[model samples]
Target: MNESNRKRGVLSPCAACKLLRRRCAQDCVFAPYFPAEEPHKFANIHRVFGASNVSKMLQELPEHQREDAVSSMVYEANARVRDPVYGCVGAISSLQQQIDLLQTQLALAQAEVVHLRVRQNASYSSSNSHGGFYAASPSNSGSPPTTLPASSRGKAIYNMDMVFDQANMGYPIW
Candidate 1:
């Protein structure tokens, strides 16, 4: 056959060329292959494709293929959301565990501090008083006893509370 008779590309009906007083050079191989029973042009292929119409095309797909596509899309989206949620929960749990551990350590240190203060007070009272339980009473030495006054004691306790509170409210290690 001559070059003019030889088809350049796959043949499909060109309606525009048909209306414009020109040959409707059929192209797009699959077009002719499509069964007449199937709907044609799917939302006027001439115009821009719309999301809603594309969705309708998906809906028209075979049941199994449509189900698989929908299920896969849903699963992928759910996985995207679920992975982050699970990670956040795990991170929060780890942070809480760290906080608990730090709180326990602070309590132990506070107890140790109290124990040391009590020991210091006992040693001073014993040394300052002549067997009297009170550090205020005068001893045979006649020197004014070294003792933490009530105001100083209150201040010390207040300082300890502030220190431990600050420690307990510390940021998570991780």
Candidate 2:
């Protein structure tokens, strides 16, 4: 027993040793990573990877790397338990899809803002040219304008309402 174990009176076996129904030696490989207080941590790992495999893996690794390896094993084991077939990969894929959807929505909103700005500029220019009063152009008599001027079109402005309608149709343009 080490100083800490000896000071605590009767030595408490580590989780791995307790689960395996064996004594925990002073130099137990699992003692540092799987303390007695956190039995579930080791339980999940043990359920996924057998006790012998964990011990052999820990023994093969350097002391500094053992802790990280144990942590990774515990995470993978828990993920495996939660999702038997796809595990962590499924969680990662779901998050990536959400990110892609959010990005598309953001791009669509940005395009809409640019389109509105172009329409506002066109409206202002027409009003200025016609004695500071709004005048309905002959191309859009008694109806709202649907297209920007040729100069504004060169600035990459498009019909935002049409773009949004297309997005609702299940096909999103890049």
lDDT (10s digit) by residue, model 1, range 1-174: 222332664333333232223443444222322222332332232123333443565567775575555444434434435454554456567789999999878766776676556555555667655564544433213444357776755345425443444345463211
* lDDT of each candidate versus the true structure: 0.46, 0.77
Q: Which candidate should be chosen as best, given lDDT against the real structure?
A: 2
lDDT of 2 by residue, 18-90 (tens): 9999988877889889888889999989988899999999999999999999999998899889998887898
TM-score, candidate 1, is 0.32
Best by TM-score: 2
Provide the global lDDT of candidate 2 against the true structure.
Answer: 0.77
